[model samples]
Target: MKPETPFYITTPIYYPNAEPHLGHAYTTVFADILARYHRLIGDDTFYLTGTDEHGLKLQRAAEAKGVTPKEFVDSMVAIYRNFWGLLNISYNRFVRTTDEDHIKVVKYAAEVMYRKGLIYKGNYSGWYCVDCEKFYSASEYLMIDGRPHCPIHRKPLEWTEESTYYFRLSEFREYLLNLLKNKDIVYPKHFRQEVINKIVGQELLDISIARPKERVWWGIELPFDKNYTVYVWFDALLNYLTGINYLSDKERFRRYWSSTHHVIGKDILWFHTAVWFAMLKALDIDPPKKVLVHSFIINKGLKMGKSSGNAVRIEDLLGRYLSSDGVRYLIARIFNLGKDVEVSTSLLDSIYNSELADNLGNLIRRVGVLIKKKLKGTLSSESIDNTLTDKADTAVHKFNKLLGEEYEISTALQEVMGLLKEANAYINSVRPWELSDPSKELYTLMEVVKVAINLLYPVIPESVSKVAESFSIQLGNPLDISVDVGKEYVVKEAPILFKKVR
Candidate 1:
């Protein structure tokens, strides 16, 4: 048999300086959904996500807690892992920047670039944000009270001068420009233009890739120079290679790396695109197959972040929704790749209530109960209704097109929800509950429900699985789903998939 097509996806290794929050959950859940979708379609998928443990910010945070850097990160990493587990993130590998293999990868890459004359020692002076772990040019920083401040954090920027090793990012400006123009490498075509515009507007300068050990000592030390450590961003980015077994397993690495998709937030666009592309070129490696960028989840008129002090806690959402699937569905429902999503409890509650509880949950309850109560829990084969079948088929088609082709996850979900709405309407029109022999109508409705639930499985796996099991429905490949009127459906029980949030 031919092998399943390889599909590799990754989330940015999060910085574990703070606990996991809504922002973290947003990105990770989105990646998880895509990963789950690929797996559902019979793809050999690998999802990678984890923590970035080395930086000056982490060093000071550890000091403030009176613990060693490793000790603090150990605890924080545990929290991140626990939170991911709570959210049902099905990551194939959880890579840490401090892992020995990752550290080695960073050092190896740096050494290759150094030998190729792409990295050189240089003195650097710039406005920097400790929170961001990045330097900002004059045009990049915001001026508040006549002083430079971090655009994201809204905090004062620090002026620092140090000797560091620099990567020749400027040399690859033409290469990156040509790359961004390909239009297929970055999703949401506008983001590709955004990167191209940035490269065209500003001269791509050589980026500092190392920090002096005297100031920040928690990172991977350079192989050639023990006095300097690899910059946090540089070190963190290599976790992608480490996660794919870049150095340890060549055949496996080649198979997965050929199909890599890096799912990242818009804030890191520059590094992931311009700098990352250059680094890969310097290492004689090809760029990733695609770089998927997403806008942020906003709260209180600011991008939700721990440092911004506007981050919503993940626990709070779980408490409100009462299940990981609820939170996942809400996020998938509101997810946007092009624009920022402003989140509020009211908005979330409305979506959960209207979509999950009222629409999907209601359909499942009605169908299962009707089958058990009226049909004696047994549904025999009968001719399927063409109207409901057409709606289900269109929904399946649009869903696959929007999600698989356009990567419009929210739009894809809307298509599925529309199917549910149609099924609910069909129920009202046919009045299955009132009919003495509504076996055909019920079977038709069940087929539509089967399609809708299968489409929703990626976003709400647990809830969908429960509904499928209760109705004895076979969750098959979404692309090939059709109205199976000949199959027998034995309803064991009507499961309450999602409880309405009061």
Candidate 2:
């Protein structure tokens, strides 16, 4: 079936001031899973992920490393690409803010906003959170250790006075509040409420959108002003447009941007739902179709970060897992939508050993072995028990409804695990290996196992491929619960899908 409507998804362009961590991997993995699910269901899907290379953070880090900002970003971009490649992220485009086309579109957006009287020159005097790269109003600043600090960054704020251009965010407060409350603009009602309280419950400030060249020399120069550069957030957000070449390719942009979904961490939820949405409205473009905000990955009960000294690198964690598929599976299983998940070596180890190796993988190994020994590596047609058929149908329906519409992955995996348990129980009850005439029981077992592998493919594509190949089966639409081992097929000798680890 051809895709009916395009599903364009984006993971927040990670700020590459540091290496990619488990927190970063969580967002990208979630986006990849959603993209893959959409693709399997026959949606024309496009996934965009990349680096935000221009910011005070990038500039400061570059200067500290004694390299130009451009050179630093170039090297960091390579690291990001390598990491995503290792994890098998199937994004259609990896955008960089420094790209020529991105700069062009950012300038275009700024010019259009400026002409509409939505941007103006102003002097900003407030607590500047260098870590967040945004200014906090007096009321928004938190007092810590008797000094004003940024609530999000937990760092002392710098009192700065600078003349910069500000975007009229206050003008869109009502529009943003209505958008959040009335539309399916953000997912998981609680997160939407968080935005509503911020916009409607309080004042929305006019955000500064430019930094003087003398202060920050590593961003897109404003089209109307030569002495200033676009703020990093402003420049970074344009990638969603430039990633699809919005300015030059109207058709491509329309096809993808018509229904855009953003996957971002909760820390930046306000930026997407408020600042970015307001910018789009100011530019006369439609707001994104939906926003999925995820909670941070924590370590030792603290959010993982370099400053926290608890950051877990993706590469280090990948080493313990047998394959990238295993790593992705555990992360998707570990993270719950809209809530924090603590990361640890032992946690992943246990989940992988019990779920993948012991439960799912063990079932696959048992099925392959039974078919090879009892049926002489050949499968014959048999009547599937109604009990097994109903189970398969229910699993497929729930998996589709949960993962597809509700975005409840953890629950979907629970459904898959339930089916796996049923398969195990069915195998135990029939004792196919011991029965003198075991064709029907073995055939039914294979069908159950086939459907389980199809459902697991979105989370662990590569590993599931091995399972499918071993049984001479082509993995198709996960929603297709039909048992398709065919009338008589030869099964290949198979290795354990996941090796048991201590």
Candidate 3:
């Protein structure tokens, strides 16, 4: 929590075969909000997001387009980076599984595991879905009318027999179970329970960690076998650490990895929780501090349901709102922790209209407009009345109290919104517009309104900064986590924070 201590977090490096979507925007926004909030509270946070370019999925997509895998991944990655950049998502590092440093670290992790006898030769024969990018155990694969179907794609999985190197995952059952019991290995508590109740609840299978070096040559080549490439997960999984590997960059890796957290999807819980921990322990490194698994975004109020043709795309949301924060705010507000949220344009519109426009935005406009009219464009640092202030006096307190312990962004925003709502109602009842008089009593009442605007600085900052400047009050002074409201405050000028959405 200290500024000097690193708070390292990462999104699951995305597969680059498809264009980015709402699902991609969901977790990145979640992490970005946390990053922005923590930095505001003085935490030294580092957030990493990027594409996982090398996989059989990308390889096949490239072939279908008649382009080399490199060409396909190169162009696709550009689109992903540009999309995130457009949304103002500030990622500290954009990791690629195909990067030279990552390739070496993956090989290093494999070699260490292999040298420690955690690796062994094996033959894998199963229904493998290239599109799904995962091998299904018979229990998981749906036998549709007789053929194996991908649980995700709901299509048949290709059967394959390959000379592969397997990680003896089944042997780590009790080890992983104890780690789960320990609870710090993964987090958001409920998702960890899901991992225990579901996949890890089933018998752990020895995972195929390498493919025939020739067939799936898109991944890190195994150090122990020139004939095989390390499996996507076996290497791809280590990126959380490779960005700060002990053997490679001991001090930096140790500092960062010791406090790492992974924000991942619920579907991939098995790899992050069970397999990832097993690999790190074999290498004598500690597992990540926590793994936060969030469920996917659903359409039409159910997470997995699809519409007739199109699903909710982040692109569409951005096109409509011209702001990613609206999308981020909806995702944060609507979903309970680790649960899927169905997003519709209607849901997006409702939040934007109700929360941002009406509550937050209208409060600023009503207050700023009245101050300008009454005070004659001169910002007031004069004391205001407590009649209007008393109604919402607890809001600033509630925001700091809730977020002081841990950054609950939505909850804090809600508290701030609650106060804004109260201030708007108070202004309506007191008729601060009619309170524009020369009396000392009337001047005191206007000061209370200015204090309320000062309280709103955290959530909708830009407008409030204008409010601060209009009165010539110092904005940054009260922005600190330990901020306190001054007795006298004034609005310098009115600047519009929210333009009415067409």
> Which candidate should be chosen as best, given lDDT against the real structure?
1
Point out the worst 10-residue segment of candidate 2 by lDDT: 300-309
Tell me the deviation in Å of residue 193 in model 3.
2.2
lDDT of 2 at 10: 97
lDDT (10s digit) by residue, model 1, range 1-502: 8899899999999999889888899889999998999998889999999999998888988889999999999999999999999999999999988788988899899999999999999999989998776688998999999999999899999997779999999999888988888647988789889889989999888988988898788899998899999998899888889998999999999899999999999999988988898899998889999999999887874322233378788887887789999999888988899999888777888999999999999999999999999989999865878978988888999998898778788999999988899889999999987888998899888999889989998889999899888899999787787777689989999998888887
Across 107-219, the per-residue lDDT of candidate 3 in tens digits comes to 88788878878898979887788775567888999999999999989988898776788888777778777888886666567767776786555778788888775677776
How much RMSD separates candidate 2 from the native structure? 3.1
Error of 3 at 38 (Å): 1.6
lDDT values for all models:
0.89, 0.85, 0.68
Off by over 4 Å in 2: 1-3, 127-160, 301-308, 484-486
Better of 2 and 3 by lDDT: 2
Question: Please, what is the TM-score per model?
Answer: 0.94, 0.93, 0.85
Q: Candidates 1 and 3: which is better by TM-score? A: 1
**Residue 327 in candidate 1, Cα distance off native in Å:** 0.2
> Candidate 1 — worst ten consecutive residues by lDDT sum?
300-309
Candidate 2 on 1-502: residue-level lDDT in tens?
Answer: 5547799999999899888978899989989999998899788899999989897778888989999999999999999999998898999999988888888999999999999999999997878887676678778989988989998888999998989999999999788877877898788779999988888777898999999898788888999999999998899888898888799999989899987999988989888889999999998889999898888777774322233367777776676676888889988898677778776667778888988998898888898898898888998864667687578778988988989988888789888888888888888998888987687887887777778778878889998888878897767888775764346656897558888666
